[model samples]
Target: MLKFENVSKVYEDGFKAVDSVDFEILEGELLVLIGPSGSGKSTTMKMINRMIPHTDGKILIDGEDITKLNAAELRRNIGYVIQQIGLFPHYTIEKNIAIVPELKGWDKKKIKARVSELMEMVGLDPKTYAHRFPKELSGGQQQRVGVARALASNPRVILMDEPFSALDPITKEQLQGELISLHQKLNKTIVFVTHDMDEALKLGDRIAIMKDGSLLQLDTPEKLLHEPAHGFVEDFIGKHRIMQNPDLMPVTDVMNDKPLTSLPKRSPERALSIMRKRQVNTLVIVDENDVLLGIMPAYDLIAKMKEITKIEEIMYPPEPFLSASATAKDAILVMDDAPHGIIPIVDENKKVIGVVTRGSLLSALSTLWIETEESE
Candidate 1:
């Protein structure tokens, strides 16, 4: 919904903060702008709400030039949140959250309802905390109040400038999760600025990597991980790295879809034949609808060959399996110190679709390291 067209911001002293950066912020998408401290991510974000005016190029929202609109009116339509959690200490939480709505000339009843609703939405109990001053709340709580204040007018676009940077690690993580959940529910176009690559990968729909006031790369987290655009991009990613957060990497991204399988109703002889043909030690047992039942190890099948007829008789319950949406880090956690070398990937109906092996995980990691080294 927001578009930056060859936007550049050069100070009178001739230092360029942003240099001809162009990108579109899709509706309902969280677009994260990440880079080093001097990379102009914050400056790019400020240009959106006209907090910092651009020297050149046009910023359009739904095709209308933002420069043409009054600065206050433009800001009113776009919610802004900063790292400092700037809430007026003297103002009660309710009053802080109601600032925008009150300015828009909302009635007392409507403003009160909005304040209470927003407080509850951000996980603060309106009845208990609404009348409290900002000084009474913790840092995280104050940040939530800031977010509630930003959303007070129900703006279509939100610009968050390192909003979670000041909080402790645990609190930062909690707020990040809340922001992702809120994005999914509210579907507002968000332009987020962060120097932390991990935060960008975790939260962004598309991460824009910037350097020296220029756009370096912009892509989804998965693509960005697998294929960085330049040496600087690779080094930036390598420093923090995607492998460190495998939980953010989807199982589907690194799965063997054509895993060996057998039906539960199949005879032990048939199951053995399938395993031998596939050169696998174990066979995944599934029903006619491909729903995963369990697994049959070669030794288990061999020991019960004479006594058992159906594969189900010798099949042991499958160890923990992952959904298609599960992450590699999740698989690692499930497989840690476990006997199973592979984890079955299932769908919503428990149908076996793929398998991710420890070997695959190692290979993925090795490949990343190799790429990072090559980039250096």
Candidate 2:
């Protein structure tokens, strides 16, 4: 656990960048620090590893004071990624990832294995890119290398300072999805700094809102959206932002109850006909009780209609689905990882309650925009 007890940073010229900030981040939590420029979010995050020493109060990690620890040793164990990526221009990808392990005197074989594992973890093929210099890769790939390098030493905590702000929208979105997947798999303690509230809501386990160097509010995304404590908090987050983002609402609100479905016994030809009539690319295959069996794609059914006997034969397992009680935010986060474009919202008995599609979710989320446009 990490805690800030009355933490404040007063510059030499007597400017207070942080004022009596107090919050604790639980282990394995991803906490986001966000505010306008000069709000001191960056300074607060940097103080975690003593990159910026606090002028007043204490910062503790696992109940030990960070100020008491050696700054070099403290930073070595805590991974940090920045907007610029900060890869050494001349260093190869393998060498870059191996830096921390080498500093601790790991043998070449161990470092090599660790580097290879991290490379694959970040979705880079080690054999293809290990020897390439930082300049050889695109902005996104270099950022991936930076992430791998940060994780090379197996740090329990990571600090990301606007890590994806430099990438193109497509790459940024893709990386955001990948980061969510990585967080779930690794469960690392992460402190991310970003000015984007939407990014904060999507990534943060909890968000810390700051203004004028003072911590205004710290709460979960749902709580922050629904219960903005201070007037500044509400204004900074935008009062109407919640209405614009339906992912903060219940999954049922964003899902369609009447999704196209097919029985496992239904012939592929019959399923294809239904797909054509409905103008959908996929169908949920259900049993006699309306319980989810699997999903059938139009392309698969079309390819196997003559070769397959039943829709079930061409259906893929619905491993990634949501319970009816799940929040829309849960569906949004996992949507990118779902193999099928559609996610079945199921009841406790495994009966399909509704389905959340890309279209359904987008339409529900964009309702405010559509209304605004119509009003204009």
Candidate 3:
């Protein structure tokens, strides 16, 4: 848990790198700070570890003022990763990862076990790569070694400053996925710095957008996309609109809560009456708890009125549905290939809560374009 209260940073030359920015990083949450060059994202991350002293305000970690703590002792407990990786060239991978543990006066046996465990944790084979020098590894491999070194001491907080910016796109994506998986497993509080909006959206639990050395907006990716705080926020997001990642937008934000429905045990005549009243040809059959049972079409009900008495007897199985947490893009893809006109949205218990149709998808797309135009 880290809190920045009215934090500001200014150089002796009168240049303000960060201007009274305030935010909190919750325990086990990955918070991303993103902005263009010189927007103070890197400076803000540096302030956490005291790499750059702030001009005013306070930074508290776990309820203690960092300014009162010894800088060296404080840094040892905080893992720091940078773009250049900064691994010693002469040191072997094993030695590199053991730097922090060795400094803390850990036993040789403990340090060796920690080195091997970390190498394996970051996807490097300990037996094969532990003894090798940093020069023997590729850029991506070196970056992974940097990450292993960061976690070598088992720190509670990790500050990553554009750590993956130098890697190729494919490797960057792979490392991002690895970091996400690692975060979920380790539950370490992380402060990530990036200029890439796509990276921020894909990885951050919440994103903090900065501009001109000031915090602009901070929110989840879904809220940030649908409801930008200002024109600058809208324009910044609009630049990446062409490559909008659907995973950032949940289906619940776009789903229709009201859908035509009928009781599973209802008479065919009653089902038909409900469908006609709603002006829909299809009816979803559900139990009292709204658990999806099947579907009934008006045509089928009308044709089988004389043959079947209950809707359940004439109802057919509904098409595949998605959970409420699924992304809007996933719904669009499912709807594009679906045989039925509507897709049911369900909860964890498989209770139908909403519906997504072609019309809804079109409306969402139209809104997106309209926002883009307004931003431009």
Count of steric clashes across candidates, in order: 0, 0, 0
What TM-score fits each model?
0.79, 0.71, 0.86
Order the candidates by lDDT, highest first: 2, 3, 1
* Residue 120 miss distance in model 1 (angstroms): 1.5
Local accuracy of candidate 3 as per-residue lDDT tens digits, 1-376: 7999999999999999999998899999999999989899999999999999999999999889999999999999999899999999999999999999999999999999999998999999999999999999999999999999999899999999999999999999999999999999999999999998889988999999999899999998877887899788877876445336666677876778998887877888777877888888878888899998887778778988999778899777877688988888888788866566678889999999988888877787678677767766
Higher-ranked by lDDT: 1 or 2: 2
Over 1-376, each residue of candidate 2 has an lDDT whose tens digit, in order, gives 9999999999999999999999999999999999999999999999999999999999999999998999999999999999999999989999999999999899999999999999999999999999999999999999999999999999999999999999998999899999999999999999999999888988999999999999999998878876889998887887455655656767887899998887899887778888899899989989989999998888777777788898787689986799977777888898998777889999999999889988898887788566646654
Q: Best by lDDT, which number?
A: 2
Off by over 4 Å in 2: 251-325, 328-376
Error of 1 at 282 (Å): 2.3
Q: Which lDDT values do the candidates have, in the order given?
A: 0.88, 0.90, 0.89
Candidate 3 is scored at a TM of: 0.86
